[model samples]
Target: MAPAQYLLAVRRLRADETTPVPTGAIAAELDRSPAAATEMADRLAERGLVEHEPYEGVVLTEEGDERADRLARTYEILCRFCRDVLCIDDYEAEASALVGTVSADVAERLAEVLLTDEKAPSP
Candidate 1:
């Protein structure tokens, strides 16, 4: 859930061209209730992953940004694998890939394998 929220926050940052994203935007991105999003933000703040100010917004700490980048890449790799290799539909692939239990090493290896295989011709 933290990963998911981080992704959402990253996306919002990219789209809005801002540092701290409004809590409302985060809530909208996650399709979560505002209270839930605020609660999550507070938890992330406690963990030193984000800096949150009531009625102001939240921004990821440097460590949080790094984690979010890795998580996003892992998610993309998993989604590609599910869609291309497993032949799952896009929607299902997106949802199913949220089971991001793999370590960073595993995710990097999987991503490399997927890229290499993509360049290989169909046999």
Candidate 2:
């Protein structure tokens, strides 16, 4: 999936925390223009990452949570590699831009290395 789409999915999951995440709450958290969060939420629902109920907050489906968790883990691993091995502190933002283009094999390889490298800096 595209990085922005993944981010939107993750954001929606975040919004579905203990307290029901209001559309306005998501909008504030994402700092998006008015209704942008709702629109993104709609797209996420269409993708099965989130489900919206009339007059109620959004919730993540089991599949949605799993996918979001996987994306988040992959992104974290990417950031660690870009920072620890590549000596880049701005890895989070850079990795965010590159995550979409990174191949699954490459991400898995990077994740393996990051998991084994005890000294790898974690974000």
Q: Rate the local accuracy (lDDT) of all candidates.
A: 0.66, 0.63
Per-residue alpha-carbon lDDT of candidate 1 for residues 4-102, written as tens digits (9 for 90 to 100) = 545545554654434678777788876678888888888888988778889987877777766776666666666666777778777444633463476
Report the error of model 2 at residue 50, Å: 0.4
Clashes of each: 0, 0
Report the C-alpha lDDT of model 2 over 1-123, residue by residue, as the tens digit: 342544444555463454445666666654664377677767878888777664565676677666665566567677878887788979987777776577656777776665575642332
**Displacement of the residue 114 alpha carbon in candidate 1, Å:** 4.3
Q: Which ranges of candidate 1 are over 4 A from the true structure?
A: 14-18, 91-100, 118-123
Residue 31 of model 1 has an lDDT of: 68
Every model's Cα RMSD, please? 4.6, 3.9
Q: Point to the candidate with the largest TM-score.
A: 1
Number of the top-ranking candidate, with lDDT as the measure = 1
lDDT, residue 75, model 1: 68
